[model samples]
Target chain A: MNEIKIFSPATVANVACGFDVLGFCLDSVGDDMVIRKTDKKGIHITKINNFDLPYEAELNVAGVSALAMYDAIDVNFGFEIEIYKNIKPGSGIGSSAASAVGSVFGMNELLGKPFNKIQLTEFAIKGEALASKCEHADNLAPALFGGFTLVKSISPLQILEIPSPDDLYATIIHPQIEIKTSESRAILPKEVPLSDAIAQSANLGSLVHALHTSDYKLISNSLHDVIVEPYRSQLIPHFNEVKLAVLKAGALGTGISGSGPSIFSLSKGEETANKVKDAIEKVYSKTGIDFDIHVSKINVKGVKIIE
Target chain B: MNEIKIFSPATVANVACGFDVLGFCLDSVGDDMVIRKTDKKGIHITKINNFDLPYEAELNVAGVSALAMYDAIDVNFGFEIEIYKNIKPGSGIGSSAASAVGSVFGMNELLGKPFNKIQLTEFAIKGEALASKCEHADNLAPALFGGFTLVKSISPLQILEIPSPDDLYATIIHPQIEIKTSESRAILPKEVPLSDAIAQSANLGSLVHALHTSDYKLISNSLHDVIVEPYRSQLIPHFNEVKLAVLKAGALGTGISGSGPSIFSLSKGEETANKVKDAIEKVYSKTGIDFDIHVSKINVKGVKIIE
Candidate 1:
């Protein structure tokens, strides 16, 4: 196959109790990249559609990630890339990660799948670093492996694909606003209090257990953030109101998705997930911010070849 | 049946990265207590067995715990308690939790199971408070529930029974030397660095996921404790040496059991567990501390009636 098309799912990082380690994929929103073999000697971006991301190989998330992968391979390869972006940029839902993962995933497909998912994650994270300023994989790993993923340790690049419950659904409300990734990261506390850190640790442990056990109530109770959210929530308009509305509407948990401008809620069934989406949209609608809502089962297939 | 006997299994709290939230039961070592009905109206300790625990109903872990449960019930009841302690005191394994849990467990059985496991955990924690000066239930919950347990939050007393793989085994080595619980806790820093705290949160999240998914390698990597173990290891002689020996023998993970004095390692299957136990014992035996070693499957039954 000289040409291949792959779709990378959007992901929510931080994931309430998990500050930097937990993330899951969203099925509805993602970015698509189509790679075509080129007679030229190097990777290049031919076009980017419906997104303002740079098309230059060094400047684009997908192009940059593919460049990293291209350099790692012993044989030289050339490709012309076209990106059809759907996951909104700065939505806190891993838009850049989708692009980064898509590039490597699409490149791997074209190269006859030489690298495994983990190695692809490494190349994708390097691509994300070019865009997000940090070589983190919380978002990229989930987008690559599907389901719930944990970047257990970044130094050794340990990415764990956690088993998730069958009935889980993700409801996300993406407000039409932009928050720079660097600015959102700047709002987090550099030093967390000992008490809060311990509480966060316990909560993160419980949240993972809830995901494993499929206990919605435990997930609800564990979906608390006293460290980054309290301060970061100030950046999102109507954050608490939307959270309360979603909880009252029966979401198992709700939190800021990735970095902000988008809020997410988790529920057991699609019907409840739709209700959660409506509730969140209702609150955001009152603020007069144009928002798009997506309710989907957790994207269990992170980045995959599109047939 | 006016008399009843039950044995409460030993527990290992902290579980490396989970500090005050996670624990699991050990199969072999525990405390046994017998409760007999008396024609009186107050709980009393009639026989104090091989251990030096206080016999007064209000002063001892068993007696104090039994007193709390006896006060909660509306019916008039009296009991004579006999303690046959096999788990050593100050072993850093859940010796005190066994007594506290055994007391309430024995009393609850005699009372025809008035309180459920959750309530028993509360009463057992009250009993632990008589000994540990705090009401934390990390060890007590697992001892009551019979598997890996997580105390997600203490505010509303949320305790979750986490699933563990059937093949998990525990290897423990208790040096005859004793370290007071207060002394071990005293050495920990009041505040952890921000970087370490975040790393610990990720480790704990991964650890819980590993337990649920039965990923042994993730369990091994996540067993690192950046907060308490570093501080408390100073109180344990040859701590690093013992850890290296066990890891080299293929133990999945190792850490201070509850506080100090006793160290525990988790491995898959009995053969690996025995090897880890031997590896640990060989290192500690050279110190001439007269250590006791145990290898057993995870006690899936927390406390059970012996008669």
Candidate 2:
């Protein structure tokens, strides 16, 4: 194949109590990219459809990811890529992950799939490291493989695509704002109280079990983030307000999506999802912050060949 | 029913990464109790079994738990009880939990089951508090509900029974030593480093997913306890040596159960469990510590009434 087009989904990391370990892909939000082989022996970004993302192959996640894949290949090949970004950067959703995952996924398909999902995810992490300055697979894992994922460890990159409840809906809103991932991380304390740590551990354990057992009530109770959310929510204008409204409006759980500006609520049905979205929107509307909202199911097929 | 009999199974708490939240019961190891209704209007302990456990109704866990249940019901009915303790107290094997749970369960059966499992767990916690001097349900919840249980919150007493892979086996060895729960607990640091906290959270999230997905490799990768085990292991002889031996013996996971003079290993099959038990025994035998070991499947039926 001379060229390949792929779509990579957006993901919600930190999943409340799960912190750096849990994340899930969203169906409606993503980035689409197309990669084509070129006579040139180096990877390059030919076009970007949205936002003034960097064009330098070494800087941009898509270009850097494609470059990493190219380095892995013994066969000499070069690629030109076009990116159609839909998930916005700095929105707490996995925008950069989509670009990074899409690039490698597209390149792998064009290269006759030499690398498996884990290797591809590793390449995506290198791309993420260039952007975030620290590597994390909470977003990349689910975006690359789809559905809910747990990063068992980061050193060897043990990633597992965990089973999730079938009928769950995610209601997300990205209020127009910018909160750098580094700053969001900086606000966290260097140490957590032992009591809070134990409680957080308990909630996270239950949350993982809830996903596997399809127990919505357990999920609702386990969505609390005692460690990160209490500190990070101050960066978002209406985090707790919107979260309370969403829960009151029938969301099973709600939290800051990844790092902030975007908040998500999970529900059992489409109707409840829409209700949660409206409730969150109701709170954000008073702030007069321009926001984008998406209600989507857990994307089971993460990054896929679109054409 | 004039008389009631019950068996409340032993439990392994903490389960490595889950601290005060997670546990599962054992099939063959437990405490048994019998409660009989009397014309008198108060709870009483008429017989003693296996240990020098207090027999005062207010002092003993069995009597205390039964008393708490009798107080819950408006109708005054006296009860007499007999204890048959098989699990040794202070061995970190939920001996107190079995006694507490057995008492409440036996009384509940005698009362024609007025309370549900949650309420029974609540009464059991009260009994445990009298014995351990702190409120916890890691052991009691699993002993009450069976299989694997996760206590997400303690204040409102939120507990959920998580799915367990059917073929799992637990191999446990209880060395003859006393490590008081209070002493085992007092040694933990008041605060933990952010990195260790995050790693612990990640391991816990993966462990929960492992139990759900039947992913044995994930379970092995996640059984690490960065928060509690390092400090608590010092109180137990041959902790690290026994652990290494169990892992080397093909056990899926091994760790200190509850607070710990006892250690438990989880394996995929009966043969592996036996091998793990023998391996753990080998290390303890060198210490010249008298110990007892049992191998059993996950107890699907937790506390149950007997004829």
Name the candidate that leads on lDDT: 2
Overall local distance difference test of candidate 1:
0.86
- What is the Å distance of residue B33 in model 2 from its true position? 1.8
- TM for candidate 1 is 0.96
DockQ of each: 0.69, 0.76
Tens-digit lDDT track of model 2 for A138-158: 999999878888887888989
| Deviation in Å, model 2, residue A205 alpha carbon | 1.7
Off by over 4 Å in 1: A74-77
How do the residues A1-307 of candidate 1 rate in per-residue lDDT, one tens digit apiece? 8898878889999888888888999888888788888878677998888867787899888888888998888665588888899987888899889988988888788888899998998899888998788889989989999999889888889987777788899898887887877788887767777778889999988888887777787888888888888988888888999999999999998888888878889998999998988888778878998888989898887788885
Clashing residue pairs in candidate 2 are: none
Candidate 2 structure quality by residue, lDDT tens digits, B56-82: 899998778777887888765688888
- Which window of ten consecutive residues has the lowest lDDT sum in model 1 chain B? B47-56
TM-scores for all predictions: 0.96, 0.96
